[model samples]
Target: MAEPAPRGITSADLEAVPAPLVAEILDGVLETHPRPRHAMAAGELAGELIPPFAPPFARGRGGPGGWVFMIEPELHFGPQVVVPDLAGWRRGRLPAEPATPFVETPPDWACAILSPSKARLDRGPKRRIYAEAGVAHLWLLDPADGELEAFALTEGRWLLVGTVRRGEMVALAPYDAVPFPLDALFPLDAPAAPTET
Candidate 1:
């Protein structure tokens, strides 16, 4: 007799699936769905992905810069599909090109931009997922507040390195030379009005 399909693996079954299977479904949905608002912020940050300038760095063959990717992975945290605004993987670890929307690999760094619809996810469970996945760095950009919070994983704990507000220039880890002004991440073009003018 033929061997039975692995426990809960099935074309129609949506419940109690394996990790890889869930990853595949998540990738498919993100690819077909319309891009979210956070995509713009992610795109802007992509311009900053460059060579690492710090010592003791693990460089990839593609050069000093790693591969930055935007992924929507189906994390088995709860009931929802938490798609991060942006994610990056070391160049050597990146999946082959044309591998559909969601790559089954955890990114080296993950970024989540807070929008009206996604504030809770970005700040809560999604943050936990990145940490659990052992993401080396994470950036949480709040466009509305015009702030960017950078975190690094040290000894498996997320440590807040910097909280950048308007006019503050923050340096990111793993790529020390790529300095970014906090104001650039915000969408506002004009400064807040002066008090008591």
Candidate 2:
């Protein structure tokens, strides 16, 4: 009989492997994995089904001047090969597209959703990696807390632009024209009522 799969893979193991090998592995895993959160967010934003605003593009856009892509990037940060939840890059700064889905180039903006499985990675090391990459914008969304934190790159460092909490309204940087209601991001449930004894 075949040996059972290992319980977990160490960062050392990941570091020892080549980047191309890592990309190949991630491509296979991502292809078979059904990312419901990504799909739900993308779908809700499509076809005017959700609120009205500029249409969101995925995997970046390419044009004469430059291109921007919303990519699920794989990064070799220290000993770990991190696949950020979402990333975007301008054409001028990106590497030539590879045949595989994962992009080696860092993005201009990176967003990570808080998940129980990788919460620390997203909030800690990943934040530092994006800052080091000089990403202009970083959005850390905590679905559990129903909060959105925005960070901007300033002099090669990250500055907290703002934090929007549930029921608060705030405009995001790079897209200041867009106004988002904080509560809209959370589950669609009726607001709690005041109780009087």
Superposed model 2: Cα runs more than 4 Å off: 1-67, 75-80, 91-97, 191-197
Give the range where candidate 1 is weakest over 10 consecutive residues by summed lDDT.
23-32
Per residue, candidate 2 scores C-alpha lDDT tens digits across 72-190 of 56654333345666665665676466564445556667777665655655677567767776678988777667677889999987899998766766477654444655555554544
Structure candidate 2, residue pairs in collision: 59-69, 59-70, 60-68, 60-69, 60-70, 61-68, 67-91
Candidate number with greatest TM-score: 1
Global lDDT scores for all candidate models? 0.57, 0.53
Per-model TM-score on C-alpha atoms: 0.64, 0.59
Score residue 23 of candidate 1 by CA lDDT. Answer: 22
RMSD of each: 8.9, 8.7
Cα displacement (Å) at residue 84, model 2: 1.7
lDDT (Cα, tens digit) per residue for candidate 1, span 74-181: 333222244566667766776454354335566677787777665655676567667777778988888778778889988878899978776666677755556756
